[model samples]
Target chain A: MTAKLELRNVTKAYGKTTVIKNLSLLVEEGEFFVILGPSGTGKSTLLKLIVGIEQPTSGQVLIDGKDVTAMPPNRRNLAMVFQNYALYPNMNVFNNIAFPLKMHHSGNITQKVREVAEKLNISEILGKRVNQISGGQQQRVALARAMVRNPAMFLLDEPLSNLDARVRFSARSELKRLQQDLKQTFVFVTHDQKEAEALGDRVAVLNQGQFQQIAPYKELYEEPATAWVGDFVGDFPMNFVDGKGFRPEWANIGSGPYSIIIDSSESFGDIYYVFGRTESGEHIVLKSPKLLSIGSQLKFSVTRFKEFRDTPQSTVGNV
Target chain B: MVSEYNNPRNRKFYFIIAIIFVIVTLIPMYVLIIIAFAVPSQTVAAYYPPLFPSQFTLSNFIGAFSGYSSILQAAFIKSLITATIVGALAVALGFHASYGLSKMSNRMSALIISVLFFSTMIPSLTIAIPISVSFLKLGLYDSALGLALAQELVVLPMTVFMITGTLQSLPKQLELQARVDGAGFMQSLYTVILPLAKPGIFAAFLLSWMMSWDEFTFAVILSPVHPTLPILIYIDSTARGNILFASAFALLVTIPVIIITLVLSKFIKGNYLTSGVTG
Candidate 1:
């Protein structure tokens, strides 16, 4: 099957600043692809380039195998949910959601709006102004607006970043479920690795306008293609020690080559994270099922280690 | 003393300042009212003006309204028509121009906006003669439409600058979202931008109308024959020395502005006018 969205050698620059440098991506149909990156990494710019909100300095953006690089945003047939949930503050929830349908001159717009609102579970607040709703509800209204059009692909730019932590956690699962049920191409961009892991079928770790690695969360965690990717994709991330990388969970109290003095330990339910310093003064964390007290010296061994070349890109994958 | 004044507990100081402000503003209007109703005998009897009307006579108002009723009526209609047209054109042009300027690069937009602000600083009298001569040659000398377009020269710069601040304050993503949600450029402008900018636009409209309604140089030079309220009032008071009639007309002219300000003051923010100029 052809990819729903494709960017070929897209290079975006403004005067002296090059935001995205020679980037390319292909999001297959019915896949939830997340672009995970730190801020100013050109993740949002990539979405803009795809949606035709901003033209790439050099690129050919393809939608369903058709070149739409020269086309305007409306003709591209893609819906974007912005980072700030850019719902029309002047319009009520109903009009805000129904705006796309009205623009296309869709028949039975009210009925269609009702259906989308029902799906998003925002039917009750349809008459309230956008500002009158909570941030989470405003987010749903934005989603409903995008979904009402039934576009070929969805370009979401950090749609859940504004929600509270409790809401964000639930919204992540809800978003994943929605994508699973709809099975449309979704290209979600966010800086949060946890969000990307939760919602992405495959997450691309982007940094400084380049894709460091793109793979499933498990693969990205277990087999990072670059040292930067290894350090970026996990909760505790990966700690670099003596020209090698390893996850905290991979090291535990056992017979090993290195010994460390435990600085402290914290417990979260079934697991304990023991933070310590190695003999060479490298900070390391060991995740263990058993707890260890502070100031206790323990020997630890890594089951596996990711060896990386000494470069800014930190090319990885040698075990 | 300064400390005492600055203290939050100083209710007496605030009351004194309030009384001073009310007196300062109301005194002129009170005097105008007293003179407007002064009978012919009272005017000739005293060399100095009376604090109160010695005798309130309806004849001054009757003479003012009936003698120059047609001229007043014509002036009233013309001023209303001119202000409304100027207000509408200024707002429409300002909205589009501000939106366009908002999309420009920072250096370019700032340069252009600086030029606009600079143009407003040049006195209207400097260009009044040239504009009047050109209007005469163009056969636009004494028409309300021509007057309105001329008034736009004064009003558009301020309106555009103010509306630009408002447009800058709005998030760019709203328009981008509108475009991705299937709106073309024009569609996004009207549906998303214009509606979102309603308060600022209305404020711009009110300011334009106020400017046009009170505009003297353009009205006096451009339409000397078809006088607007300000022109007629000026001529009546200064040239003809009809203080009573002019006071009544001046009072009449102020009513709409006062009403508009009172009704729409919340939308007309001082910060909205100057917020994004430097930023």
Candidate 2:
């Protein structure tokens, strides 16, 4: 999959204070790309820029090779699900789903709504007002509302944050399946690394308004391009140790230059911080060792791992 | 932990307040209904302690409604027109202004809020004198149009105050979602913003209507030919011998205002405390 949507130097500023820096990203077609970051890291703002609720201070948004930088949200052909769900309270589930169709003036509005309602398992409550439905059903209606239009891109802003833990898990799986089935791009914004890892085809690690790295979920986890990305996308247990940034060949955990291996030079940022730890149950950290076997096509069935460090590492800008 | 004594004290306090409240409230209501229906007796000995009407008939309604097409009916019609005109104009302006204000920067938002507060603080009476002068000079004085326009200065700011609070409570995500759903800005406002803010709008409309209905100072000073109900009652009672019919005419205005308040009571959160006191 290649970029179906791209943001070129997108920035958003409020008067004197800039919220989203001159950032850029590419979301591949038919792929689930997550802009994962902590709160106020501009993940949501990036989604907003793509959707055109707010214009970039200076940037261009390209969709399928065409520049849609100045286009309104409707013109962008991107559907969004908000944290609040934003289902119209006055409209029933059926009408809410039918609204976009009616706006498009595409016929078969009823059949379309019914098809989506049935698919989303909300057909039973199609006649119920949004306020009268449960939170999960409201979310379903919101999703259905976005779905009925068949938008080119789906921009979700932590839509499951309000759900209970159990519901969140279920909605997550269903969402993944939906994306796979539709074969449409899904750009999700979330703080949870687990969510990004679980759902994303590629995860774009963002912090402080800039993207640290964008890679496939497993690659991002295993070989983070930057230390910030490593900390952000850490799922497998790996002890982060304290060490100064040094030349990759000369970087050491102890006395002399120790053997340090990386998948590629691209993962080697300007500085390399070495770390290592000892003992079976005791904590350990090292300048990450070469994650390779004698064979080039080796596969690891191992699922759990942890990281430990002897001393504290510097938490500098852009990690 | 709480004590049982707290409950007893609360109950005792409520009992005392309830007794005093009933007496104070019922006494005026009891007297107004009586005097409004009764003609003043020629003799001082005619003052009798009767809770029920000795002679109940529709004559009071007829007497209040029929003569010279009556002070009550004309005034009622006048206030109705003034309130409808002022309320609609004020609410429409206030509703959009608040939405515009909400989208502005904090400093600019502060400027708008300060303006709203400042306008409300300077009582209408302070400006009424100058406005009355200007209107008189412009040949706009002593007309219902003048009265209604003057009432707008009061009603507009109030409408904004109430509606702005309602709009502020609505999350910004709703609009963003609406935009993402393909609604244009105005479409989002009508389909999402207006419906969500309806409670506040209804409440503001009723309050503005009341302000226009009960606005006596301007109505009295401005509209000489077409007096609103309050002004009509004041003029009718003050003009020497015609004072005899004042109570009956006052009762007529009272009836309609009460009915409207009752019907729209669900939307008006603080109606009971402010109704008579404000007027």
Which stretches of model 1 miss by more than 4 angstroms? Answer: A1-3, A310-319, B1-23, B38-55, B262-279
lDDT of 2 at A287: 34
Q: Give the range of the ten consecutive residues with the poorest summed lDDT in model 2 chain B.
A: B270-279
- Model 2: residues >4 Å from true position, as ranges? A1-3, A241-319, B1-27, B38-62, B105-110, B117-126, B129-140, B240-244, B265-279
Candidate 2, residues A15-35: lDDT per residue as tens digits? 887878888777778989888
In candidate 1 chain A, what residue range of length 10 has the lowest lDDT sum? A310-319
**lDDT score of residue A97 within candidate 1:** 90
- Could you list the CA RMSD of all candidates, in the order they appear? 4.5, 9.2
Model 2 docking grade: acceptable
Candidate 1 residue-wise lDDT at B189: 93
What are the per-residue Cα lDDT tens digits for candidate 1 across A243-276? Answer: 6888887775677888889999899799888888
